[model samples]
Target: MGNIKKKKMIFLIMLFIAIFMIILAIISPLLISHDPLVTDFENVLQKPCSEYPFGTDQVGRCIYSRVIYGARVSLGTTFLLLSIVFISGLIIGTIAGMSGGIIDTIIMRIADAVLSFPDIVFAIAIVGILGPGMKNTLLALSVIWWTKYARLTRVLVMAVKDKEYIHAATMIGASNIKIITHYIFPNIISPLIVQLALDIGGMMLALAGLSFLGLGVQPPTPEWGNMLNEGRSYIQTAPWLLIYPGAAIFIVVAVFNTLGDSVRNLLDPKHI
Candidate 1:
């Protein structure tokens, strides 16, 4: 009982943090300093003070501004990535599961083949091929991320399709598309939600990783990962540079993971 209560408290804290991060992301543009890209050589490497709460970067760009803007980038990419992956996954997974037999085997095997690749490596290859910048990142994420969703949803669809209601729908001469859209998807929505929520954290981490590797958000763009990358060289002289951005990434990912877990538990109470 004590453990349960503690877990609940932790979950709530995480949920609050997630909400806070989201709010920060939404209001980033208004909250940040004038033009995150604008450099002030005089203020370079300034410590946290009344004027710049988070301090200034090595190049005199406001840390506070960059972080707020980076929150926007992080959250925006998460949403866009999930949207693309979710729709593609649902369609492919639904078709594969509902069709079954050779079709199922073929689709699942393809997904398995894709999944066999190390995620970061696969993303890097795709991004490298597509060249750098936001479009390439999105393209890379969409290409690789869909496989997990497809696999999970395919399995889920298979399980849900076997249930009595699905059988009843089939017996009533419902078309495969209708049966799937009306039955399988609704039943599996909970898991999909959980998957999406969890994937947000992973996606954010991936985005940051890509930026750190010089393949994601370009410099002067005020992205969290890029900011961290800029800070790496200055770690010996200005540890705060790395600390703030790194902390942002960690906290946001932790929040998403916690929220995902809470939602999963709530949706599947039997598991809890």
Candidate 2:
């Protein structure tokens, strides 16, 4: 009970932080101390003050504003990536799992081959081949990330395929498409939702890691990953730059993870 309550509290806190980050992203222009592009040669490396709560970056861009805007990119990428993965995974996994025999073997094997490579390696290789840009990052992320959903969906669909409703639907002369869509799809949705929440957090971290390495968001984009990359040189002299962006990544990831855990618990039949 204590652990459950703790998870709930953590999830709530994370939700609030995520919501605040979204709000900050939307109002960043008005809230930032100065234009994110404007450089004050004299104000370089100034510590956080009443005027600059998060201080200024090496280039004099407001750290607070950059962090806020970074949230926009990270969160936006998470949503886009998750949507593409979920939809594609659901369709592919469902078809492959329900079909069985040669089709199932072929699809699962192909998915396994894709999943064999390390996710970051696959992302970097794809992004490098596609060249640098946000679009490349999206392409990189989406290409490799879908396998998890596909594999999970396949298993869930297979397990539910033999259930009474699915069998009844098949016996009642329902077409394969109708049975899969109407009966099988609905039962697996809860698990899929939980997986999505967890995947979002994982993807956010991957995006940030890619950005920090220059394969994700490019410089001057005010993205959290880019900000961290820019701040690396100043780690010794100015740690706030790293701290602020890092915190933004940490908080958002934590929120998604917490939310995922809570949903998983709620959905578990034994727990309920």
Candidate 3:
């Protein structure tokens, strides 16, 4: 009982942090005191002070404001990217799993081919071919990200398709779409939810890494990754420049990961 209570408390704390970050991302621009992109050459590389809580970067832009605004880019991208991946994967996997035979084989093979390469490498190649930009980066990440969801959904659907409920639904002349939506989807959703929770952190990290590599958001965009990249040059002179954005990434990732783990534990049948 004590253990369960402790777990619940942890889950609530993580959940609060995650929700706070999302809300912060949405309202970041309004919260900033200075223009994130405006430069003041005289204030360049200023240490943290009353006027600039996070100090100024080499270009004299407000690091505090940039970091706040960056929440929108980083978190917003993760949300949008995952939404597409989840929906596309669900549709494709549902179709492949329900249809099976040649269709299943073909889809699975394509997924396997994509998965065979390391995700970062494939993302880099796609970004390189498509050229650097937010849209291109999203397209690149989405192309590879959906494969995992598709594979997981396919496996889950296959496992449960032969169950009595599915068989009964089919016998009742329910269409494939009806059967999948009404019967199969509900049973598989818990695991998918858990996967979504976990993948949010990974997607953030991947997007940040891409930005760090100069293939994402781009310069002066106020994105955490781009901020980190920009701040790298000043590591010796102004460590706070790097520290603030890096800490933002680390905290957001950690909270989401903890939330995901807590969700998994809560949803696990064995625990219940």
Candidate 4:
């Protein structure tokens, strides 16, 4: 009983943090101390101090402002990616799962093919072909990442489709839509939610990586990954530029990963 309470408490705390992060991302522009894009020639590479909390970068942009606004690029863009992939994957997976046989086989095979390549490698190829931008990055990743959700959705659908409740529903003449909504969706949604939570950090890294490689959110724009890339040259002279942004990614990623675990454990019957 005590453990259950503890688990709930932890989950709530993590949930709050996750929400706070998202909210911060939403209102980031207002929260920034200086224009993240505006460079100050005089203040370039200033260390953490009264005026610039996280310091100024090589171009004299506020490291603090960039880091704060970076939440939008990191978390905000990721949220968009998550939604796009989730809906598309859910639809594709549900169709394949319900259809089964040839459709399922073909879909699974395609997914397997996509999964075969190293993720970042494939993403690079796609973005390369698409000519590199936020839209291309999102499109490339959406095409790549949706496969996991689709496959997971299909598996979940197949597992529950044969259950006793489903059989009972069929015997009682429940409409297919009714059965899906009343029974199938409820059972499957929990896992999907957990998967989404776990995906936040990974998706952020991928976005940042693309930016780091000069393929993503292009320069003068304050993205964490790109910031790191820009700061790499100045690593010896100025470390805060890299350290602060890197820490932001690490902290946000850790928070979401913990949130994912919290959701899973809280949802587990054993834990309850």
- lDDT by residue for model 1 over 1-272, one digit each (tens)? 77567667767887888888788899888898657899999999988888888888987988988888889987888788889999999889888888899999998888888889998999999989888887899888888888888888888988888899888988989998798778878888988888787788889899889999989989988888888899999898888788888998998888788888876665665646
In model 4, which runs have C-alpha deviations exceeding 4 angstroms?
Answer: 168-175, 270-272
Q: What CA root-mean-square deviation does each model show from the true structure?
A: 2.2, 2.5, 1.2, 1.7
Runs in model 3 deviating more than 4 A are 270-272
TM-scores for all predictions: 0.91, 0.89, 0.96, 0.93
Tens-digit lDDT track of model 4 for 1-272: 89888988999999999899889988998999999988799998999999999999988989999999988888878889999999999989988888899989999999999999888999999999989788899999998999999999999999999999999999999988898889998999988988887888899899999999999888888899999999999899999989999999999989988888888888766646
**lDDT of each model, Cα atoms only?**
0.85, 0.83, 0.92, 0.91
- Better by lDDT, candidate 2 or 1: 1
lDDT of 3: 0.92
Candidate 2 to truth, TM: 0.89
Better-scoring candidate (lDDT), 2 or 4? 4
The C-alpha local distance difference test score for the whole of candidate 1 amounts to 0.85
lDDT of 2 by residue, 1-272 (tens): 88778767766777676678778766666776567767887888889998778999887778887787677777887788889889988888987888889998998898888899998998899988999888898888777877888888999999999988888888889999888778888889988988887677888888888989998878788888889999999998999999999998887887778777777776666554
Better structure of 2 and 3 per TM-score: 3
Candidate 4 structure, TM-score to reference: 0.93
Between prediction 2 and prediction 3, the one with superior lDDT is 3
TM-score of 1: 0.91
List the candidate 1 regions with Cα displacement exceeding 4 Å. 1-13
